[model samples]
Target: MATASTIFSDCSSSTTARLVPLSRIRNGILQFRQSVSVGWKPKNPSLNFISTHGRSSSSIVTVAMATEPSATVIDGKSVAKKIRDEIRSEISRMKDATGIVPGLAVILVGDRKDSATYVRNKKRACEAVGITSYEVHLPENSTEEEVLNSISGFNDDPSVHGILVQLPLPPHMNEETILNEVSIKKDVDGFHPLNIGRLAMRGREPLFVPCTPKGCIELLHRYGIEIKGKRAVVIGRSNIVGMPAALLLQREDATITIVHSRTKHPEEITSQADIIISAVGQPNMVRGSWIKPGAVIIDVGINPIEDAQSPRGYRLVGDVCYEEACKVASAITPVPGGVGPMTIAMLLSNTLVSAKRAHNFE
Candidate 1:
């Protein structure tokens, strides 16, 4: 007989487990329970699942081998903090050595509160890392020519190392046209078609990667999660997060699947992925059942759902159900603290990189 190990040769070796079933004696007397070893080694093991099928009298209990504990909490907040510290230290060294202070310019065309908040947070992050931040806020009714002119001015500014046009520009403005006007050299937001095109090609590098996607990949690398040969699924196909995320994963040598609104049986497809990045805006769209045990989850959704119990009348949740995922995933990121902080961190990082490249500073 082919042993389970031989049959599943591709599976990573961990502790092994044995299932024990209880049987009733004819006289209704309790029989001595036999010991069964559940998988990872006897001391530290892998994931063990339980299922029961028999008459009502039968009882099945899962006894996991005394293995390693539950999955790790991939804390993006702390990770981002560490990255910011490093960036600040490097910026300090560069300023002392060469008197170059990296500068980022943010162009906001409208007055959406959410957009304003994001821009403010970005500015704060830049300041925290010793990067000078320049801002240009145009009226919602500003002309496309005005927007383009503003970008051209930033492009001519030698001190500006990076230029980011806040997204969701006014309805009157052409997003693609305006985005392309920003100099490719200063395209720190990484939305330029040229940059995205380069990102998709082998042996090619982009001037910058989309911040959110870059942040997602950064989280995986920092956590020491191997991506070279893993199966990865990215939920959502938005340009900002999903589409680029899949491309980035491919660059890392991970097999990629994208589950979007048109994807049928998304659960089945997602369950097969060793790494799942849920960027879909739907709240709790990816359930526990959709996850395979021991898979790593990086949730990018930040949706506000009604929660009358709280003073704000709502709470933020990720596309993946956190409570349910905690039971099955090997590691998972929380909603607010996970991908959010990393986005800004990557923005700062890209700015620093842009400055280094521009000044020919190693």
Candidate 2:
């Protein structure tokens, strides 16, 4: 059995070394954690392939790396900022020409900290881009009827162009029924069945696509990643991201395969894809071996794992193990700064579009 000490030695060499999958070396290793930052050099340079910074002398582990360019870090944060800037300019123009400003209304029915943070971020994003933000916060015990009433109010308000109900509503409430109440025209989060249905059908378009999935596709487009005729794999089948993402990719003329819990040998399918969008929400679930060299990866999962070294007591990681994927993939998105920002940017975008349509503004 090749032990961790044998696999990773205190040595330096000019030759390259392929990273062996952790699964294969787990039995021989003392511990392993994904690296949050990576730098690539295709020549003689000190390689910090994997960090064992806090380890005891007896458990020190380090691995050599291949002299190849790492995957391009898809800068979704910058791209999203650019999109927001574009929206800001467009909103300014629309307001100047027609006295109309885009507005977004959000209904929150619970006290979930994460949900509140998301709504708060969204409101700030809207304000940053000249969009009027309206929010209604209800207690956890609020009735579905109360939530429906809020949606109805937003729906009837012509000034409010987009409406979103923060997800994972109280267990007592019927999510589908509440989501269905948001007028299809104002469904900025794009959870409305009509929007999803329209997205799945050809020769038809939805009023809005789900923000996260839409953002994933937008990232690919902005990066000039070709989707047409490409083999694409979408991990997970959740309605919010996975399903709609597959539909969106198919619309782009990509041959698609969906990998889910029931998938047997999911790696085989992913390894064959040219583009992979993973929304499984499982941290570091996709390994390097699952990726084809030069493939594009859009990681939609923002999973938090414990990290004592951080101020927050934890850190966020993507569904794809970035350290591994960065080596094999041509381009990839990082977790906290990647698709996260784009989701809000897309929401603002949908609001702008809705306002344009409502006012017949060009």
Q: Return the TM-score for each candidate structure.
A: 0.81, 0.84
Candidate 2, run of 10 with poorest lDDT: 23-32
**How does each model score on lDDT?**
0.75, 0.77
Per-residue lDDT tens digits for candidate 1, residues 45-90, read 2222322111121122212212323456778899999999999999
Model 1 deviation from native, Cα RMSD in Å: 14.6
| lDDT by residue for model 2 (188-220), tens | 888888989999999999999988899999999
Report residue 108 deviation for candidate 1 (angstroms). 1.0
